[model samples]
Target: MSSNDKLPQLAAALRFSVLAYAMAYGVSAHAASEAVELNTLSVQSSVIGTSEEKDVAKYPGNRTVLSQEQLKKTAATSIDGALQHVPGVKVQDETGTGVLPNVSVRGLSGSRSERAQFLMDGVPLTLAPYGHTGQSVFPATFNTLDRIDVVRGGAAVQYGPNNVGGVINLVTKPIPNQWETQISNRISAYEDSDNLMNNLYLRSGGWLSDDFGIQFSANTLNGDSYREHSDTDVTNFDIKADWLISDSQELQAFIQRYNSDMEMPGALSPTAYEADRQQSQRLNDDYEATATRWHVKYLQDLDWGNSAQLEVLTFGHHDTRNFVWGFNTAGGHWADPAQPSTDIRNSPREFNVYGVEPKLSMSFGSQDTLTQNLILGMRYVYEDVDYRLRQTNINTGAVTVPRDWGLKTDAVAAYVSDELGFMNGRLKVTPGVRFESIHMNFEDRNSGATDSNQINEVLPGITAAYNVTDEWVAYANAQKSLRAPQIAQVRGAGDEEGEVSWNYELGARFTKGQSSFNAALFQVDYKDQLQWQSATQTFANIGETRHQGIELSGRYATQNVPGLSLGLAYTYLDATSEAEGPNKGNELPYASKHQVSWDATYDFSGYLSTLSGFYYSDAYSDNANTVEEDATGATGKIPSYMVWNFNVSKELYQQNNTTLSVDFSVNNLLDEEYYFRGVDTSPVGRYPGLGRSYNVTANLTF
Candidate 1:
């Protein structure tokens, strides 16, 4: 049967599920309200509990935490900008505003960040975590985040399937203990342009009583990018509530809404790029999206006296996205320099996802003896997606629908891990395993074609950490990871298998009075890796690939110059394919060999100033490793580039209950020219990068 015939049943099921969840939670809240109030204590509910320096030191792998202070010092307007400071992380700037993110870690493909797992407040951020891993529609805003935690290894047992690259968790702001209000605004403009961009943020929260608290935050952006005809508008709002039922029980919930619309300045041909890089060739290309999401978590402290705890989390979201672009018949791509077409094509997609997870943690034994900690968890997720494409004749004012399809996915996963401590708690080792079962079905409404697949896998991992001294630690880990075939791949003719990989890492960290350093060497052995075929617009299984890299980072404070701090991060990667194809033994596309970043900050009294620079080596745009530039500017070697930034901020007033501050920043201080190929939407031409820009911001708090 066609998916159109099952719409009513799906709608009914969704409504019933939402109603049941609300009713159950409503009763629990009422019961808690009648209980006696107790002293309130902060809770650690995220996957990485309480992302503090001390907590990170004990983890048996490489980890980095960007604190609130560091975020402020960077003065980054987008999450992509903030991540540039981390070693082994690559961010491709498709849009200057960072409305869409293309991030990669450890030389993995950065296309839509499909190789990495992204989480918001410990919940999956992609449209469908198992069915569709690509992040085509992202609703996160930098201003709403409190911090970012990145884990490079030792996370596969707890999170999967696309965790070969790493895990990135975005933590949001928490409710304040007392009443508070804040407002901030920033305006930015580019060089040699009159266009201006405006960003506004508002946050207000407070504790209504000892047991209940609520917070609300909103961020809006309206601006023009560095390129012509690239205007963007985005708005995000969220509300969070915390209910402290008792000293041992707590409930937290949040609801968020996001909407965005942006124009796509299509890529430029070689000749067009040389003429004017920032000019838009395709006028009718644009993107629009909207999303509504919510999540609820409950924590219970077990009475087993062994420091046992139980956590239950439930989350859901509905998202819709529409992409419209002009098709060039002469050039056989989206846009052509020789001939630009008026024929328009629109692809609209809608997705719905719901999930529930329950976890239990406990500890046994004492410090004098061998201590052990155990964790057991289970998760279930459901996803439904609808895709449609329509073509329009601009001259005739007529439209036709050519394609329509639907997909449904159901996945279940269970995991268990135990950590054993020896040598008076100085050495720790953890062993874990995870099992996943997934089923997917796809149906074409127009052609009456149907396809289905099922996948079952078991992943295992082990990690060890040793404390060499009071301020030094060494860690090593090995893990197996997997990525299921996407919905589109399943619908093709060939039978696709899930991609699998084995990852290894060795790292050490040191921290003393005024210095800290971290280093890690990592390698990945990937099997059945997928590669995109531009001619067929499908993916093929490429066998036997390897990625090896080393990351280094350090920070120090100089005693000679009070309040002066210096930081540096560097990465070197080698990625190659061993498949029996034409591209065998070739380096992966978009994977640069070297990357570096350095920053210096100085504080004088209450004033602060910072300067930073970033550089990346050249890379190829295709698996063939083409060196010469093609006519369309698609297949070529990208040129190396470097950029610098400067920021200064000062507090103008700080009194009893009010504070005021101002900041100014200049990005791309050197005004370097750079471009990228093989980007989404316009993969056949050169895409220009951001040029020199300046921003000024003012903030008020009470």
Candidate 2:
């Protein structure tokens, strides 16, 4: 049967399931007066938890948490820099300010982070989660985030569609219990350049009443990259509120606005890069974007002897992005050399998404013996997108519209998981399943052509964890993941079927007084995987690919060396295509084989110092695995690179209720020279990485 035939059945089943769950649990709200105890719902419900050490021990899969203290020690000016310390993750930097995030997990394509699921405060961060997953514009800044949670496996049952790679949650700061205000500023200077960048951050929050609290945060950055014509301006503002409606109910809400404009220094040819890597040839290339988002969550405790809770969350966002490019009319490369533009192309995209999710959690039995915790949830989302392209002549001042289209997507997902614990909670097992139904429609405004497609999938997963000793735990998980074809693919001539894969992982975590270690072995078998083609600026399916790897990370505080700590993370990946094509047995693009990172920190009295670095092995830039560079500098073998960083901070002043501190950091301490191919708009030239940069920051709190 066709997917369209199943749509009605799927919709009816979902509606029935939702209604049944509501009818079974809705009565608890009226009987709240007989609740055993009062418990306030945590705002960070979607994340693992704030206590990293304890949370990691009980989780059934590999997890990494970068705490606020760790983020401060790294002193990274961008989110990508901080993510380098994580295992099984790769970052391709296009802009030093992290205006656009290109991050991948477990050998997935890092071009625009299309394969991974990105979340901010448990809400989707992409322009359109179901229509266009590419992160053309990232709305959050590094300083505004309180922490980061990287879950590499066992997330398929809770998060769907594009979760084959994993889930990355950027957690924002919460409202404090007491009134407080903070102000911070950072200044950055690059090597061989006089341009300076400044970042300012302000935040204030506190409880207005015993049952109500609110927080406000704002961040602004104005800076220039290492190259000329690479200036960037970004602003982000957010306000959040939490209300304790009653002893058994609570509410949380937030609204955010973000805007950015940046000039893109287009790529350069090999010869041009050799001559001067920091020169801009495409003067008219730039990007601009804006986003407005709001979210609300309500939690209610049932009167079923404090064994159940219900949560309802709703969110919506509107995003607009525009890219302007200048090209030569003649038959030559756009960045061959600095020249006046003959034609200009403008592409703008707009997206609006609204979603609502409701979840119910119930517990049975006792923890001392055998206990089971069941979770049932469902989500419905609607997305609308507008895409347009226009061209203008530089000399004649003539304008023309070439392409204009609209896309609409309706997606629904339902999931259920039950965790059973035995041996006094020493051994735990969880089995879960998720059902997804998606419907998409596309319309070409110019041609008046329309098309529609539907996709339905059922994904299942199982995970187990065993506590061998008080300080050690072992875990394993296996799951099936899926991602629907994007809007472009649905509109184009490519296959409309969704990409599916099976993922498996085995890991263990150990912690002993001031020491911790984690290791995992993972593998993924894909029936079909989607890859970005830079030349065509579209996605194509690569059949039958396999990715297997191992990740290791550890931290230690040495007793011999007082006030000193060390950390290390490493990964070895083997990602290959087994399809019956010319690219068979070839290594996937941007899939680095070996990655390593290490860090050391010393804290004494009122001073703290840190040294850190990361290394990435070489990988191909195209599916053909071309060894030699082309004239356009598009396809070639990316060379290996290693970079180091150092940071130090000191407490300058402290009073009864106020404190001041200063810190300085030097990124790329050795001034490494590196370049990337097939990145962003500069798909045909070498895009140079940032050189050695220095930052000075001052923070004050009262």
Candidate 3:
């Protein structure tokens, strides 16, 4: 029993079988204190941060709320697998399809990715008719979310200047409250027992009176390649509607579609891709992607007496995406093998984007004793981009022309926030500010090159909270964030700029009855940032960087439990880079200086259910430790490992309602093999992780 004592005896026998199935599912103790007052109230935020409900008492920064039963027990299949359980987030994949997964949160990666800011249902999925650059490759699944509002550090006065490293709304799901219908299905590795994932889902909702409402959902999935010619097929659709023309007025609408097809595996040299993850190969090339989104919203509420209140909202979105990416350099052996030339690299690429965004919000209050609370907002955006690259003339393979290019942008914003309450409401204070502007362009349909640029920004925030009872809360915050550039960081040339950050936070929150806790300690200070030059495609900015941190989360429900539950999370990070060239003090490249996660679940007494989990991380760097590897060098860092996953589930039903479920998982399950991302100087090293995988999912409901 040496693998770390079999993972703490499998996490104490799954926490004593979920505390004996929550004491035989009688779940009492005042229904776990009314489920902790419905898990800290506050329903909708008018579509992402600041619609009202004072978004966590005035919203100043660092938010994280995932409900819908924590996104249906993380049975996620998109939207980056539901944000990988939030908490510094990280999801990487250069291949194996999953449409180019690589979404970093606190540590931001790639083109410096204008640091987070993804919203839907309040639009802002990078604005402009869903304009691309959420690091396109069409990766964002969770079928069509129901909840996921994670705002971490500097939201730049609530999403402005492309927020510098935080904010992801997604919300979706609502409209149910009556007439309902559902169906679900899942079957893995269909025949052969080894790799044939399948999934399906359908949903419906109702409410055609007293205000009107509607909802719809659809999903599909097909798989056979976690890796091996990397196969995949996915589809999704969603729709929502609502209208309430009384007590103030409201309107809403949303539509979404997503599609995927993958089969690319092009980098292999880190010891032959860790020997193809220890011989689990089928590498190939060629991929596909598609996306669509549409949205509309309108809201109004007014009353200007002592209970002063007024609001207005507007939104519109349309996004279309298409894709194809390359790689198959004759199975590796570069050193001028024409530098990755599987016949000059059979190419096929295309990227397109279109965008639009509109918004407005307002609020005020004053009655007597200490009024407290005020908010203001504004937004407008437009975008268009299309890029194509096609090459295949090695020995006349045809298709040698298409290398078009395009880009366009126009953005605007304004913001204001205030919320001060001296006690009575248990003290709270918040200050906010926002201002942004942008106009960027780049076109080159065959040497007819064009360029344009313009930028402006101002962001600010301040927060304070002191409840210290009635379920505790104590907070402090400071914010300022910005990110612009990116029309390819400003066009047909190079000069990169558009990154800035400044965030500070101190937090605590606790809820009694069924226990709950949250903690925060963040510090960010960055500027210019954006590096990746050292054998490069050119890019630099480095200069002063930091990301100190601490995050702790908790959950409990075993007070003589019912269906049992327990959750835990811990994070401690320390990123560096003090400018002055060559990565000042190193670090910061794939973060991870300690991370932990734990989970336990149980729901017996029929339908069976059991869950187990464990995750730990601590290791980093793939570059920016000031490069160096040979030349007697040796400096790439990267070595770090800690993985374990487990799952079990069961549910069956037929006779027409047809509900069926069966899940079994074991990822990395103590295999200890490592390297999930990060490898420099191509030679495709480090990419293992995925040994010991056995997932069998089967869900069917109607």
Query: Which candidate gets the maximum lDDT versus the true structure?
Result: 2
Model 3: residue 364 alpha-carbon error in angstroms: 28
Per-residue lDDT of 475-594 in model 2, one digit per residue for the tens? 999999998877777765444668899999999999887778999999999887665667875566767888999999999997898869899999999998887788999998889999
Task: Please give, for residues 1-702, the per-residue lDDT of candidate 1 as tens digits.
Answer: 444654665565456445534433422211232222212211122335655555576677888888776777776778888888888888888888888888988878887788879989888898889878888788999889889888888888988879998788888887888988989998999988887889899999989999899999999989898888889999999999999776656788999999999998877888888888778876788999999999987766653324555667789899999988877654455555445776788889999988878776666666667776778887878888888888887788688888897888878899988888888778989898999898888888889888887888899999999999978999999999999888777776535667889999999988776678889999999987776677876678876788998999898987888879898999998988878889888998888889999889999786899898788899888889999997878798998888898888999999987999998998888888888884666677888888889999999989
Ranking by lDDT: 2, 1, 3
Q: Judged by lDDT against the true structure, how good is candidate 1?
A: 0.81
* Estimated TM-score for each candidate: 0.92, 0.92, 0.32
lDDT of 2 at 650: 93
Model 1 has a clash total of 0
Candidate 3: misplaced stretches above 4 Å?
1-62, 65-79, 82-99, 102-132, 136-149, 152-154, 158-160, 163-228, 231-388, 391-396, 406-426, 434-445, 455-510, 517-554, 559-702
Off by more than 4 A, model 1? 1-47, 332-334, 396-402, 532-540, 558-560
Question: How many clashing pairs does model 2 include?
Answer: 0
Give the CA lDDT, 0 to 100, for residue 96 in model 2.
82
Give the per-residue lDDT of model 3 (tens digit) for 1-702: 123433453355345434433333322111110111121211122323532222543344457667655545544434554465677766554543244556676666632133667766545665332223554544345545567777775355756655556666766667765656666665543212256666677787788776787888887777764545556777878778877654544556776777777554433335455444533222324555566666555444323222222233334333343433333445533321113444333323343332323232322332224534455655555556565566554455766545676666556677776666664657767677877776667676788767766667677787777887777778877877767655444554444556777888888777676567778888888777655565765556665678788888787876586878877777787877777866577777767767666666777765334343435364445446534332211234555555555565666556654566666665445656555442222233345544455556565544
| Local distance difference test scores for all models | 0.81, 0.82, 0.55
Any runs in candidate 2 off by more than 4 Å, and if so which? 1-53, 332-341, 492-495, 530-542, 558-561
